[model samples]
Target: MSIWGKFAGAVVGAYFGGPLGAVAGTVAGHYAFDRELDKEVAFTIALIALSAKMAKADGIVSPVEVDAFYRICRVPEGEQRNVARVYKLAQEDIAGFEAYARQVAEIFADRPKVCEDVLDALFYIAYADGTLNHAEEVFLRRVAENFALSEADFSRIHARHNPNVFDPFAVLGIDPNASFDAARSAWLKASRENHPDQLQARGVPVEILHLANDRMAIINSAWEMIRKEQFNKDV
Candidate 1:
C-alpha cells in the first residue's frame, strides 16, 4: 500500500502523542498505539504540519502557497480531505511551530539530513508565492534553529529558494574567493547530498523526492554559473 493508504489506517495519534497526535486522531479517528509507525510517516506528518504553520506565519496565507503545499506533498485526490484535515488541524493547534519543530528534531535526531530536507520543503512552500517575506524568513529561521541546523545550513537552503537573489557562492555554501577546485568540490558534495537517492536512503518519503530534484537543479545552476564566471576570469 502507498504511504497515504498506510496513513489512513495507522494510529498516528497514538504513535505520536502530542499536537501531531491530536492532528492524526482528529483526522484518522484512531487512537490505538501503532508501534509500526515509520520515519517516512513521521516525515510526511512533520512536513504537512510545518507547512500549515508556515502558511500562517506571514498573516496572509496565499492560495498559491497552499497550492504549493499540496503540490509538494503530492496529496492524492482520494486522500486530499484527510491530508487537508491534518493541515487544518495543525494550523488550528494551540502549540506553536517550535513544538512541532522540536518533535521533528527529536524524531530525526540521528538523521540530520532529513531535518535539512524538511527545511528545504518548507522553503519550497514559502517561496511558491514568488517572494519570501520577512515574517516567513524569521519563521523558517526559528524552525531551523529548533531543528539544530546551523546558520550556514539555513543560508544555503534559503539561497536555493530565494528567487529575489541569486548568489552562487551562497547556494554552494562556499566562499566567493574560493578556488575553482574548491568550488567544484563543494558542488560535487552538495549534489551528492541532495541527490534523490541519498534523500530516500536518509528517510525522506519517495513521494516528495521532487524536493531533491528541485534542489539539485538549483545547485547545478549555481555550479554552472560559478564555472562560467571562473572561466571568464581565467581568460
Candidate 2:
C-alpha cells in the first residue's frame, strides 16, 4: 500500500476508539503490500538462483558472472543494498529452483508456445550481456532438454539468443575420422575458440574465462573419447 493509503486506513481505524484497531489496520495494510512484494521478490530470487547455478556449472563461480547478473537484471542499488537479503534469497531460490522449474513446466503445460516464451526469457537471462559461460549454456540447454522441448523449439530459442561459439566438430572443421590428426585438429580448433583470452576479448571477463577453459577441457575430452572409439574399431 502507498504511505497515504496505509495512513488513511490507520486513521479510520483510530477513529473507532481503540489504538489496537489502528495497529491492526496498519498491519493488515502492510501484509497486503508485502504479499505483492513477496511475489516480485520470489520471481527475482528464482532467476538469480538459476543464474548462480548456471555460473557454477563450469565448476567455479566468478565475480564476472555475478556482475553479469546484476547488469542483466538491472537490480537497483537500493534493493541490492540489502546484500544479506539478496544472498539469503539466492540460497533459498537455488534450493527451490527445481521446484520452480517444475512449476513453470506445469504452468506452461499444454502450451508449447508459451513454454517457448519462457525458454526465451531464460535464454535472455542466461546470455545477457553478450556471452553465456559454458556452465550457463549447459544449464540452459539442460533446462530445455528437461522439458523435452522439440529440437526445432530448442534451435529457435538458441539461435535467437545464444552464441554460435565453440562447436566442437565445427572447431576442428573435420568429420570424426580414423586419423589422429583429425582429432587433434578438432581439439586445436575448439581450444582456440575457447581460449581464455578470446573469452575476455568477447566480454567474458577474466574471472569467468575459467568456464571457457573448462569447456576447452570438455572438447579435448570428447575428442579423446571419439579417438578411443575409432581406435578400438580399427583394432
Candidate 3:
C-alpha cells in the first residue's frame, strides 16, 4: 500500500488532546490504525504539520523550502492529498506551533537523535533558499532550544545546510582550539549516532534515514579537515 493509504481516514490518533490529537482526530471514526505504522505516521505528521506552522512563523514560505521538504522527506506520487490534509489542519490549528513542538519533543524525548533529525529537517527547510531569513532563523533557534539541542549541535546542523559558509569545527560542535583527541571522540560519537541503519532502527522515515548517509559524509569531512589542519594527519 502507498504511504498515504495507510493513514487515509484511519484516524491520526485516539482521544489524546491538543493539536496533535486534533490532527489525529481527523480520521472521524473508530478505525484501528496499525499500531506500528501509527508511530511512523506520527513521525511524519509531526514533521509536515510543524513545517506548516513554521512557514507561518517566518511569514512566508519559499519555493526552495517547499522543495526541500519534498526532497528531505519524500512523499510518493498520488499521496500528496493525504499529506496535504495534515498540513492544512496544522496551519489552521488554534494551538501554537510551540505546543505541537513540545508534544513532539515529548514523544521523542527518549530518542534525542530523532529529535536531532527533526531539528535537521527544520534547518534544511529554512536554509533551502540559500539564506535562512532572520525570522526563520530565530524560529528555528527556538526549536533547537526547545529540543534541548546544545548550541554546538544546533550550529553543526546549521553548518551542514550552508556549504559555502560551513565551519568544519562547527559541524562537529567544537572549537578550533580544542584538542585533536576531543575532536576525534566527538566525530566518532556523532558518526555512530548518525548512521543510516541506526536512524532507521529509531523509526525515522526511510528518506530521512538516507539523509544519514550525507550527514555521515559531512561529519567525516569535518574530521578530515580538522585532522589535516590541526593534527597533521589524514582520516
Identify the candidate with maximal lDDT.
Answer: 1
Evaluate all candidate structures by whole-model CA lDDT and list the values in order: 0.86, 0.47, 0.75
Error of 3 at 131 (Å): 0.3
Candidate 1 per-residue C-alpha lDDT over 149-233 given as tens digits, one digit per residue, 9 for 90 to 100: 9999999989998878899999999999999889989999999999999999988888889878888999998999998976553
RMSD to native for every prediction? 2.0, 15.1, 2.6
Angstrom error of the Cα, residue 213, model 2: value is: 33
Q: Report the CA-based lDDT of candidate 3 relative to the real structure.
A: 0.75
What range of 10 consecutive residues in model 2 has the weakest lDDT sum?
A: 14-23
TM-score of model number 3: 0.88
Q: Please list the residue runs of candidate 1 whose C-alpha ends up more than 4 Å from where it truly belongs after superposition.
A: 11-14, 232-235
Q: Arrange candidates by TM-score, highest first: which order?
A: 1, 3, 2
Candidate 2 Cα lDDT to native: 0.47
After superposition of all CA atoms, the RMSD between model 3 and the true structure is: 2.6
Model 2 over residues 103-122: C-alpha lDDT tens digits?
44543354433344345546
Estimate, for each residue in 38-129, the C-alpha lDDT of model 3 and write its tens digit: 55556777788778888877677667777788887777776777677767778888888888888778777778778788888887777777
* Best of the two (1, 3) by TM-score: 1
lDDT of 1 at 151: 100
Task: Give the lowest summed-lDDT range of ten residues in model 1.
Answer: 7-16
